[model samples]
Each structure stands twice: as C-alpha cells, then as structure tokens.
Target chain A: MSAEVVPLPARAPSLGPILSLTQTSMNAVNQIILDRMQSEIPLIPALAGHLIAGGGKRMRPMLTLAGAAVCGYQGTRHHRLAAAVEFIHTSTLLHDDVVDGSETRRGQSTANIVFGNPAAVLVGDFLFARAFELMVEDGSLRVLKILSSASAIIAQGEVDQLVAQRRIETSEDRYLHIIGSKTAALFAAASRIAAVVAETGDAEEQALDDYGRNLGIAFQLVDDAIDYDSTAAEMGKDKGDDFREGKMTLPVILAYARGSDEERQFWRDAIAGFRTEDEDLAHAVTLIRRHDAIDATRERARHFAERACDALSIFPESKARAAMIDAARFAVSRGY
Target chain B: MSAEVVPLPARAPSLGPILSLTQTSMNAVNQIILDRMQSEIPLIPALAGHLIAGGGKRMRPMLTLAGAAVCGYQGTRHHRLAAAVEFIHTSTLLHDDVVDGSETRRGQSTANIVFGNPAAVLVGDFLFARAFELMVEDGSLRVLKILSSASAIIAQGEVDQLVAQRRIETSEDRYLHIIGSKTAALFAAASRIAAVVAETGDAEEQALDDYGRNLGIAFQLVDDAIDYDSTAAEMGKDKGDDFREGKMTLPVILAYARGSDEERQFWRDAIAGFRTEDEDLAHAVTLIRRHDAIDATRERARHFAERACDALSIFPESKARAAMIDAARFAVSRGY
Candidate 1:
C-alpha cells in the first residue's frame, strides 16, 4: 500500500505572534553563536560554519532565550548562553550520526555521511570545546556547573538508549529515564542556565527549568510517536528505521507490553532477530495501532506539555512567557 | 628469514626507575579515583567501577600526578585531578573503540566489544560527566578552564585524524597537528592543571605544560612507530591495522614520501584501494623499513623526548623531577 505523506503545516496554530517573539529572542542568540564559533583551525571554522548554517529547529536555544526573557534578563550573556546550548545540541547530533551509523538527517545527508565519521566525530568535539570556551567567557561558575552536569546527563541518556535497544522488558519508566537524560537534560540545562545567568533564583528559576524539561520530554515523545505514525516520506526516513536499528522507542515499548503472546513473540523475533521484511513492518505497525499505543503516547506528550505550560505560572504575565507556553502546547499539537 | 620477537627488556636502563616512579604515582591516583567515582545511579557506579578496575596503563592519569609532584604540589586535590584526567582518557577510549569498530584495547576485549557499543559509549560519557563533577568540587576555575579546553581539543584532534586518514598528502605538519589536538592536548591539559592545582605560576607552569605537551607528542610518535614494528601477536592485533583502516601514520606517510615512484604508486593503491591482504601488509612494511621510516620516526620521538626533558629545567633538580625526565626518555627508548 502507498503511504500517505502528511506535509508539515505552514501555519502552526496561533504561530504568528509566537514565531515573532521566538524569532526576536532567537536572533540575538543565533548571532552570538555564529560569531563565537570562529576558530584559527580552518577545519574548525569551516565545520562550525556549516553546522550553524545547517538550519536546525533551534528549539533548545529558543527555550533558553525565552526562559531568560521571561525572568526579565536584560543582559547580553543570554545570547552566549543560548548559543552554547545550541552548540552542545549540534555536537551531539554529529556524534549521534556516527554512533548510529546514520547517513541522513532531516532529509539531508548526515554530517558523518557527507564529511565521514571521523570528521563528524572530531568536528562534534570541536563544537563541544567551542561551547565550553564560550561558556567560560561568561565567567559564571554556576552556569558552568549546570552545563557540565547537563552535558554528562545527555551523554548518559544516549548510552542508556544504546544499551536498552531491542530488550523486550524496557519499561515506560526506563523509556522516560532515557528520554529525560538524552533530550530533557539539555533543555532543562539551557533554561536553567538562563535563570542562573540572569540571577533569577527561588521559585522563578525552578519554574523555568521545569518548563524546559517538560517541553523537552513532550517534544521527544512526539518525535517517537511520529516515528510510528508517519511513513518514510513523511518522516524523511524509512518507517520502522528505529526497529531496524534494534531501538525500542515508546510506542514499541507500549505495544510489546500490551500485545498478545503471538504479537509479543513477533516483536522479539522482528526486533531482536533483525527482521526487516515488509511483512514484519506491517505487522508491527498493526500491533501498535491495535494496542492504541499511538494515542497513549500522545496522551503522555500532552501531559508533559500541560505540565510545561503550568510551570510558567510563577512568571509575571508577559508576551515572552506566554509564547513559551504556546510553544510547549504547539510542540505536542504540531503533527496531529 | 624468521622474524625475531624482541621482548621488552626485563631491565632496560631507564625502565626500572621510570616504572617504579610511575607505579608509585599511579597507585596513589588509582586509590583516589576509586574512592570518588560514585554516583546515585547504580549502573553508573557499577560501570565506572568495571572500567576503572579494568586496569588500563593509566598513562594519562599518571602524567597528571607526576606533573603535580614534579611541580612541587603538596595539595591533596592533585589526587582528584589525576582521577579526573584518567576518567576523561578512559571515557575517550570507550568512545574511540566504538568509532574505530575495534574490539580490543590494552590486550583485553574493549568495553564496546564486551559490553556492546551503546554501553561503552554511554559509560564513557558517564565517566566524562563524572570527571567534570569531580573537577567542580575543586572550585578551581583554572583547572576547569584547562580541562574543558583540553576536552574540546581532543575531540577536534579525533575529527582531524578522521579526515586525514585517506588523504595521501596529509603532511607531517598535519599529522603533528592532529596528534597534538587528539592526544597531546589532554596530556598538556593534565599537566597544566597539576601546575594550577599546585598554585605554581609563570615559568614553572609553562615548564610543566611544555613537558606534558612534548611528552605526549613523543609518546604518540612511539605508538605510531610501534604500529609498524609490532605484530598481531605482540600488539594483540594485526600488523598494519592502521594501514588496513586507511590511516596514514608517520611511517606510512614518510615511506610514501621517500619511496620510488613505483613504490609510491604501490602505497597509493594499497591505501586508496582498501587493500588488506598479507602481501599488501608485507610490502607496506618492507617499503617503510627500506626507506628508513622507522629510524626517522624514532628520531622524531627522540626530539620530542629531548624537548620534554628540557621543559623540566625550570624546576629545582629533585628525584621526582628526574623521574619525569627519565619517563620522557623511556617513552621513546623503552621498546627500541
């Protein structure tokens, strides 16, 4: 059967005001990252330029800028902080592609595929180092402490996912733990750094940090859900690619737990056995749908989105704060 | 002619003192590392324990301790600093093995090979994160600054080596540049941190920093030299493994440059063509040896060693300082 391709909506719900606010905040951060990424090593500068120019969603950086703005940060260091956040994210992507042996990302050839694994790995390291250098320039040991911890958490999450792949008993808690480490840790760090940078303490800092973490969790859950719901064309990669790589994301984890004995056996064979036949793909998708794993996963995402929005209650009502809440909602509602 | 297996001498001129000193320093550092590598995550503690307990050469950590001692550091933080240094090195090895797709390290199956790549990668990150956490406890921005920078340089070096692997004209300058970033940067950083932790200023700091850098370069030169000299049995891997991987270490780079046009053509085909047969290995080795690549490489190693010893002149002559000097010389001459 031919799969239906769902185009990303040109207009996200009420995105006009939100985009303008996000863009204004993000522009300052983006400019700083570009400027600071310069290096004497030709390759370092070249690769940095390529990555900065690559047009990532800038989700984490935007979160950082928005978080600081909501807390009334008038200082310029937020821009540097945001850029450091993006560099960390980008560096991870470079290394991630190498680890996964992936050849493409976001419909473009992966850096590893284009630049080769070693270039991707080393360049990733360059970005990471550059990020630290940028952070040090800000001279906030508190900020440094937060970011270093976040980086470690992010690495741990990726490692957890690596070890847990294709294991039948991977629980929802395990899934949450992995996603929290890999994805939410950085998001939380980015926003928290904004708070630390701005010297906004107590309830406001905690609120903003919670907001970032929840939003990140919601974002990743949505991503995992989409992997199951979307096709190769819609997702810009093959359907069940995660399964092919022996990854058991949220939907699969849920389905495996809820499926019949035969269905459970199928997952064991299909994922663990490395079965890539079309029949296996069709069957796996059917089982996921039959188990209503998609809806269940979406509910989890919405829960996190709501929690993210609720975290903004401590912030005095402002356009920037409101936009952040909207973005959290929009993250869950985007591909619906 | 049957190849003669030249055993590492039981009592080489410098090995006895060097080994004894390194052993003493390493034992202290190892104790500190073991005591501190704890975490809330049971997996983290377990995995870290496994890795630290796996008995690496601890060359990098020893460098940090020796650097501190030679610089006349009496502080206890050097122990943590040494452990931090080792953790970073160990973490990199875990990731490096995964990236290189190798299965053995230090004459044992690699963490990636034994535990699988995901575990190895994540555990490596765990160690990295743990290192930062440990460093933060020291409350020395100088150490953090040096370490963070070293981390970045090391990653960049790995990337540079990745790109440099297949290119035939990868210059000696480029080789040094890559090694400096990848290997020597950490060595330099480890020693520099030791100096900082000791509160040594200016000349002494620069001396130890230079000592670390030169020693690292010498160490790598010996490593590259040995890649051509050792075998699968002796090295615990195949001879020409680097050649097989299309890596152009110093010997191959020199041989290719110095060989006859026909010999150069042979190398070009062997490297570029992905040739990995026994005959290809034999020819590559023969060409490299016939061209005096080994001798030339050894000379380069000696130069760096001499430079390392020269860097120690700033310090008052002492047993610890003498040992460090001997270690530099031993880095070059021990195997030869």
Candidate 2:
C-alpha cells in the first residue's frame, strides 16, 4: 500500500492536523498495540513490531478515533477500538506481503523477508486473534459483529484479488469490488464501530461507515496511482511492483480499457505472459502515463474524497470534524 | 495432527458411542458448518471445504456437543458454539498445513498443496473470522471471551512449537505447555462454554473444562505416538513427517533424551541440519521403538485420560456422561 497521500504544496497539510487532533487517543492506541502484539513467543512481537513500528500513518485507527471524537464520545474505549483496527490492518499487511512475495515495505525489507513465510503467516493469525480478543473485551456484540464480518469480507477480497491476479481481462468494477471488501470493509468497520461505541444512532453510524468506505476507496485509488507515478522510495516498494505482480490496479484497468489495440497486447504480454521483460515496468508506466491513466485514477480518488467529506456533513463543525475532512484529503494526496 | 484414532480389534470402541449419543446435535453442527462456510468469493469456502470436507473425526466440536448434552442443555446455542469450535479447529488445520509444509491431511492433499499457500493462509483467516461471527451471533460475552482468548493461546502455542522445532533441548514441560495452549485450551473453552450456555454454575463449568482439557492433551499425545507407530494410511500423513519437519513431538523428545551419543548426532544431522539421510525416517522410527517412546507416550496419554474421566465424576451416570467418560478412555486407547 502507498503509505500516505502526498498533498499539493497549496493544500494546508495532509494527516498532520488529523494526527495532532487524535494524539492523546492515538498514544493510548499505540500503547495497547505494543502491549497486545507481545507474546510468550518472541517472534510474534518481533515480526508484528517490525511492520507496526515501521509505521505508515496509522490512518485507519485515526479514522476510528476521529469518528468517535466527531460524535462527541468521551470514553477511553475508542483507544482500544482504534488499536484493534490497527491490529487488523497490520495482520493483513503481513499476510499480503507473504502472498505478494514482497521484499520491501516502508522502505525496509518486508516482515516475510526478514522472518519466513511461515512466521509471517502465523504471526498474522496471532495479531488477528488479538484484535478479536480486544473487541471481546470491549463487550459489544454489535461491534464484534461488524469487525468480524469485515475481517471475513477482507479475506474474501484478498482471495478475489488472488483469483484476478495476472488476468488482463480484470474489469474496473471487479477492481472496485475487490478493494471495497479488502480495504474498505475494515475502514468502514473502523469508522462505524466508533459510532457504535459512542451509542450514536444508526444515521450517524451509517454516515461514518460511508465516510470510511469512500475514504478507503479513495486511499486505494491514489495508492494505485502512486504505484505507477512514483519512484521506489516514494511508494515504499520497488517501482512497478504492481506491474511485476500483475496486480490489476485501476491505472492498469483504465489504460488497458482506453489504450490502442497494440497497447492491450503489451499489458497482456507484460503481465499475463508470466515472463515480465526488464523494460516491462518502464513500458507499463509509459502506457499508463500516455493514456493519462494516473490522472484519471487520481480524479476518481478525488471523487471519493468528496464523498467521504460529505458523509461527515451531518456532524457539527469541530476540530475533529475539520481534521476528519483533511484526513479524506490526505487519503487522496499522501506523498504521491 | 493425528487425523483419527484407529481402534484395535481387541479393545472397546473409541469415539463411536460419543458420536452416536450426540448424533442429532452433530448433524445440526454439520449443517451450520456447511451453511456458514459458504461465501460469495467461492475460494473461501472452496479451500475451507477442501480441508473441512477431508473428513476427520470432528472431535473438538464433538466435545462441545457432548459437553452440552452432559449438562442436559435443551437449547440450540450449543450447535452454533459447536460449529464455532469446528471452525476454529479447521482454521488451524489450514494454517498448520502451511507451517508444517504438509502435503497430506486426513489422507488427502493438504489445502496448501492443492490451493497454494496464499489461499491456505487467507482462507484460514476467513474461517477464523467466521468463528468469531458465530460466537457473536450467540450473543454471549463470556462465550466470545473464552473462544477469542483460546485463539490467542493457540497462536502462541503454534509459535512456541515453531521455536522448539529443531531444538533438542526442548523439555517435556515446555512441550506440554505448547500443547496445553495450542490444543487443550480450545477443548477446555469448547466444553466450558457449553456450561456457560446451559447456565450451569462454575463448578460444572470447571468440571467440563478439566475433562476437555485433559482429553485434549491425551488426544494430542496419542496423535504424537501415532505419528511414529502408524503407517502413512493410518496417520493420514507420511510416516515420520513430524521428524522430517523437525517438530519436537513427544516420541522424538524421549528418544533424543534417552539415546546414545551416536543417536544424538544422527538426529542433529538429520533434523537440525535439514538433510534427510535416505533412511533417516527408518532410523528415527527404529530409535523411537528402541527407546519404547511409543509405549511411554501412550502411558502418559493414559494418565491424562484418567484425569479426564475423574473430572466427569461430579456428573451423574447418564448416557451422555457415560459416553463422555468413554471418550476419555477412548482418547488414550484407540489403536494403542
């Protein structure tokens, strides 16, 4: 995943205001994360900490914290909930890195690379279990139902992605559905559970769910864009890593749809052929740029970002509300 | 895992009575398993079904069902909980196959082998989430707490086993701890939660927990012994697979502790060095036999079996209670 959204110089700032707004709650979340990640087996904490501490803006948990804050929640339970959200996200990352055979994450070697696939897979399971444990402690069936269902959907999304891997015929709709479950389900649950915790009514819960769902889609669209447009350093991944893996991101889908017939063959040869040329990545980038796929993807991200902001319109204006809007913007703009 | 216990022709039957007694509840649990395992992604259930459908004795869920019956529960909540218990067991099997690099389970191709590691791991996560979902639907915080915590402990046990993989110094106490958390904890939780659902008091809960815990440990010990003594057909895995994987099962531990210096070197070279001599498995089996590790392991299993039966002493002599006592005896005696 692209770690953060890169804002244009003209924008006030991305994630900064949101981070500071949720700082106290975020600190508690971090503490819970540290305490919960540890096990009698050192490898769990070691593998988990490597990814969690490598730290790409803890945006999901931030959404949860901000959601609770925006709803005028005064209790400390959101901290535990936020930490649980982060654990779910981190667990997925560990498994994703293994599935993707990724070597780098957050500009460092991936956990699967440092530890083994077995360790990564088992530790991921441990973290997921710990997330549920936290939710159980929170003592709300609704919250548990939401998060657990999100986890199931997330797994489905990952499997769907696996099925779609290297297939040139993968459609934009399919791509959105995959991301909707894989990425946005957790995001939606993270935001929606905050309202549940705050005992806010269904309307507020639905609003926050929409906000997080749209924000997550926007975040992923920009992440897809960053994969093609940014260098290895900016993406915290090898350049054209998506192209290498034959992952059907939006830019690829858009370019494949809009490109000349010859360009379609190039994508097929480069990705689905199972023998990526050394120039395949660079060639893929050129075609993506030539068709303005990156720009189109970013525009779609902007659309979702707007929707995310609109979802929060029901809440009264406050620092939390304003920061949440910036977070939506940040989701689209992070360091691209 | 030892897929099933094959009974000797001369001995009293194992698992048969328990299965017959809980036939109705088992059928309900089985139906739920089929229903809940279904998913839109198809791969989730497909991979899960590949393992779940591979057909082992559904012993864990059987414990949950029998636990409820022994308590004279009339409600259907135990069916859901029993399904949850099976899901937890099935989820671990998926992950465990990947971790063990196992090629066969219950005498069939392992899910990881058939579906690939990525599918195996993600599907495992999906099943686990479904388990939590079932517990949430049951709408009891106590049930949720027990199962989730068991999950965490199981993960820890797997990691601890990973740590002990090739370490000859791995103690019996440490090994027992690993099995306690990884295997018996779930059994304990499964049985105790039945009491929770039945609204049985703490005394009954504790009794059932002890019964299940001891039975689980006893089950695992027999499983370990079976790995050494049983044919590939009997064990449903390659003979000496644990030794091949460098797993510190009880027989290996006993043999290593009791062996000659030459035998120790052989184990070190074969296991820790990660090179299998052509006859390594044969040599290992011979050494295990020479040390009487199989009988010794069976003896220990019998000890746990007695404890399991003793824990059920509080309950009156009913068919359910009698069947449960036989299960403990069956746990140690099947094909030994």
Candidate 3:
C-alpha cells in the first residue's frame, strides 16, 4: 500500500483572490481552534494537530466561515463552527481510510497506516467528541441540530456507497442520493448552520444551504473526474484507487452505460474481482474518454457550480457573497 | 467463530420484566418504524428491519419512553422518539461489531458476521441517517442537539477504549469517562430528549438526565461484571470475551491491581497475545474472585443505581418513577 503513494504537483493553479478571501475568513477561527485543542487529555492534542496540519483543503470549514460572513454574522461563534466542521470532516477521513484500507492521503501516509486502525478510529471519535464539546460551548441548539443531522447523513452516505459497490444495477438516482448524503450533506449543514446561528430567515438559510450542497456536488464530480484523468503521482495515490476498492463513481457508471458490450464486460470483471491491473486501468481511462464521461461529468459539475452561484443571488451582493461564489467556482475547477 | 457460539438460556428470571416492557414499547412504535422505513430505494427497508430486529435490550428506547411517561407526556412523539433511539443504538451496534470483530451478539451471529462487514457498516449508516429523518420530524432542535452530541460522545468513548487498551496504567476515572461517553451518554440523551419534548423544567430535565446517566453507568458496570462471572450461555457470549479481545474492563483492572506478581504476568501475556487459554482464564477468574473484584464491581454498580434513584427524588413520585428506579436496580442485581 505504501508503494502506491503518488505525489501530486506541489502547487495548484493560482487562485489569488479566493485564497486571500478564504484565508482572511479562516485565520482568526483557525487560531482559536489551535488554542482550544490544547488539552489535558493525554495524546489528544498531538494526534489532532497531526491530522489538522495534514494539508486538507479545509473546504468544510471554509464553507462554514463563508456562509456566516455572507449572512453578516459579526460574532465569533462562526470560528468555532468552522473549527467544528473541520473536526467532523477530519474525523470521518480517519475512519474512511481504515474502512477503505487506503495507505496514503495528500501525498502522506494515511493515519490508519501510520498509527494503526485502532488509533485512527479512536482519534476520529475523539475529534468528533471534541467537536461536540466545542459546539456545546456555543449554546445554540439550532447549530447543533444541523451539524448532527449532517453527521448522520454523512455516515449514511458512506453506507449507501458500501452497499452500491460492485453493484452494476445501482441507478444514477441512487448514486446522487449517496453523494448527497455522504458529501453534500456536510457542506450544506456547514453553510446552513451559519444561517441558523445568525438567526437568518428560512429563505436565506435555504439559499446558503443550496449553495453549499451544489458546491459539494460539484466538488465530488470533479473528484471523480480526477480519479480517471490524473496520474498516480498527481493524485497522491494509485490511479483507479476507487476501482480497486470496487467503488462505482459517476464516470464509471456513465462509461458503463454508454460503452459497448466489451466495455461492460471489462467493468464486470474489474469491479467483481477488485482488480486494478495496468490494462484494466488503461481500459477504464480509455472507456471514460471514449464515452465522453469526463466531459459530461465536468458539465454536470459546472451546472452545480452555476446552481451554487444562483443560490447566492438571493443574498444582497457583498464582498462575502462574491467570495462565497468564487469559492464554489474554485471547488469545481481546483486541481489536485 | 461459529464453533464458539453459546446458546443463551431460553428464559431468565430477570428477562421477564424487561421483555414485558420491551414488547409493550415495540408494539407502540413497531408499525410506525416499519411504515416509515418504506422507501423507493431498494435494499434499505430490508436492511433497516434486519438491524432493528437484531436482538438488543432496547434499553435506550425504553429509557426514552419510560422518561416521557414518568414526565406525564400525553403526546405520541415519544413513540417516534423511542424508535429514533433504537435506530441510533442499532447503528452503533452495527459499527461496534465490525470494530470489535465480534462474531456473536445476543447468542446469534452479528450483523457483520451474517451480512459481511461492508454491509453491516453501510446498513448501520442507513439506520443513523434514518434516525436523523425521524428526528427532523419532531422539529425540536433540542432533541437533535441531544442525539447528535450523544452520537459524537459515543464514538469518542469507543475511541478512548481503543487507545487505552493494553495500557495497564489506565485510571478508574478514565474508565468512567469511556463508559459514560460510550454507553451512558446515549442513555442520558434519550431520557433528556424525552424531558425536552415534554417541555419540562430544567430541574426535572437535569434529574432525568442524571438518572439516565447513573443508570447507564450501573448497566455497564454490571455488564463488565458478568463478563467475568457468567458463562458464555448465561451471558450470551463466551466467558472471558473481553479478556480475549484485550478490552481493559473494570474487573481486569481491579484484578490486576490486587493480583500477585504471577497473576500480573498472566494479564500482561493475555492482552499481548489477544487471548487467554482456559487455564489462564481460570486463574484470572480465581484472582478476580479472591480479590473481591466481582463484589467491588457490583458495589460500584449498586452505588450508581442508588445515585440514579436519588436523582429522581424531585420528580413527582409515581409508578413510572418507581419502575425507573427498579430498572436501575435490576440492571445490577438481575443476574445475581
């Protein structure tokens, strides 16, 4: 598994405006998280910091801050909320690596691979618990509800994915449901909670939520596209990692539907056997390209990005709102 | 693993009262959950039912109903709340079995064993997601907050236990923290949510929450005790199951503190190897008994039971309250 680690290009294309906006929104909150994470509980701080500093895009936390900023939340709770979102996201990643038996993440060894499954799972739980503790301090039941519901949905989405594995008959609707629950739900919750915490009305709350949800969908579609397009080194792990795990992402599903009988047989054998041989990988890539799955997926992702921007149109135009829109666009276009 | 199956007794004296209460509660919420579980999504209902019907004490749900009844809740939401609690518990159990690698539960094969690990995990996630859907229907942000926090705490507790395993220096305080988070947190959440939904005062709500927490602690202490004293058949598991799994339960901790040099050596070897031979199990059992660890553990359980009862003193004295107290006592004294 360690042998499969692929180092991606150290630099993504410049996003100066988006980067500056996100950094400004997140800087204060990130510091607070750093301070609060210092704990008497032995080894917790060390483990948490290791994972937090592991070069995550901090997309969930950024969504949270962006939502709050867009809604004119002047208070400090947004920082805590953003931190809580990151903790939940990080915790899930820890458990996910264990479940998927992955060895590398972000060009580094996965926590489960480095610290063992027990440590990874436990640390994930610790982060989750700690996140709750932080939320409790905020004393907003509404925020708590949104975040909790998101956690449940995320867990369910993962489960749906698990059941869908190697299942050729899984519909696009089911696929949407899985991704919505697993990925978009958290993004939605992060944004929506900001509205809830700020006591925004239902209309604005729903709009921000829509923004986050569509952005999340776009993000995942881009991820699926990259899985087929990127080299192992560029992706920070093996090519066809999802395929090796028998995961049926959007591209594969689209390719399978559009491919010839021979292509379908290739999927059957590859997925059923959990095989990621060089030829199988090459064929999958070719099939995705041949069927225009990559282009279709990208188009769908852009549609979501547009939808996200549309959701933000209801809010009075402001720098924060513009930043939030840019963030969505960034999610769709960001390279690994 | 199949060869290790130990059939529990068809009947037990303690189970009579529990079964009666459980059956009554199930009848109330059974159809509701069944109806609500229906989905256009294939495999979800069957999987959800399999999980709900999977044998559990229904302790959390029972606590929810019992808490509401004691608080004089006249509405029907308690039934839904009960089902929600059950779903959360079942989801955790699904994940727990996978994490623990347990083959048997309630004298039957575990979901992970029967359905495979991936299915068990995913189905667990489904139940958790279903739980959120149910929670949103209540529209009480408080209930969502409680359940979500409980979920996070539960996950954290499991992680704490994982990290603490084989570390002989683990404190009783830490043990309490782990069990309270893993087990009592949800129990407390169930009852607290009942009080919240019933629109009770802070005092009564705190009382019920404390009651649930102490009861949960006592329940887990008894479970730990039985792991040492009860047979595989009696306990619905192999004797020394915890010891075999390298779990550092209260009995093992107490015994280790009191054991001779040789006995300590036995524990060190058992945890390291992940099993204890029959003779080693016998020796460990003898040391636990001789050191009065069983009685000490029982005493601790009783203390918590008393604390649970004490918390209910402020509640209007009624049959429901009496039953709640009896339930706590039964938790510790049932097998004895």
Best by the TM-score measure: 2
Give fnat of each prediction, in order: 0.56, 0.78, 0.32
Backbone clashes in model 3, listed as residue pairs:
A159-B122
Residue pairs with clashing backbones, model 2: A4-A334, A5-A333, A5-A334, A5-A335, A6-A333, A6-A334, A6-A335
lDDT of 3 at A288: 89
lDDT of 1 by residue, A223-319 (tens): 8888778532365444567877878788999999998898888889877856778777777788899999988998999999999999999888999
**Please, what are the lDDT tens digits per residue for candidate 2 over residues B1-336?**
769988767858467789899999889999999999999887888888888878868888988889898999999999999999999999998899888889988788999999999898888888999999999898999999999999989988998888888887888999999999889999899899999999989999999999989989998998889888854236576667787788888998899899999998887776684656547788888998999989999999999989999999888889999899888897787655
lDDT of 3 by residue, B1-336 (tens): 467868887642243443454466667887777776665454566666666676556788888888887888878888888888888788788778777888887777777777776566556655665676687677676776788678867876786787787777777888998999889999899889888989988988898899999999998998888888844228655567787787888888899888899888877888676446877778778888889998899899999989998999988878777778778877888557
Arranged by TM-score, best first: 2, 1, 3
DockQ of 2: 0.72
Model 1 lDDT vs. the true structure? Answer: 0.79
DockQ of 1: 0.40
lDDT tens per residue, model 3, A137-201: 78676776788668867876786787788887677778888899889999999889888877889
Interface RMSD of each: 2.5, 0.8, 3.8
Better of 2 and 3 by TM-score: 2
Off by over 4 Å in 2: A1-13, A231-233, B1-11, B230-233
If the candidates were sorted by their lDDT against the true structure, best first, what order would they fall in?
Answer: 2, 1, 3
User: Hey, what RMSD does candidate 1 come out at?
Assistant: 6.7
DockQ of each: 0.40, 0.72, 0.28
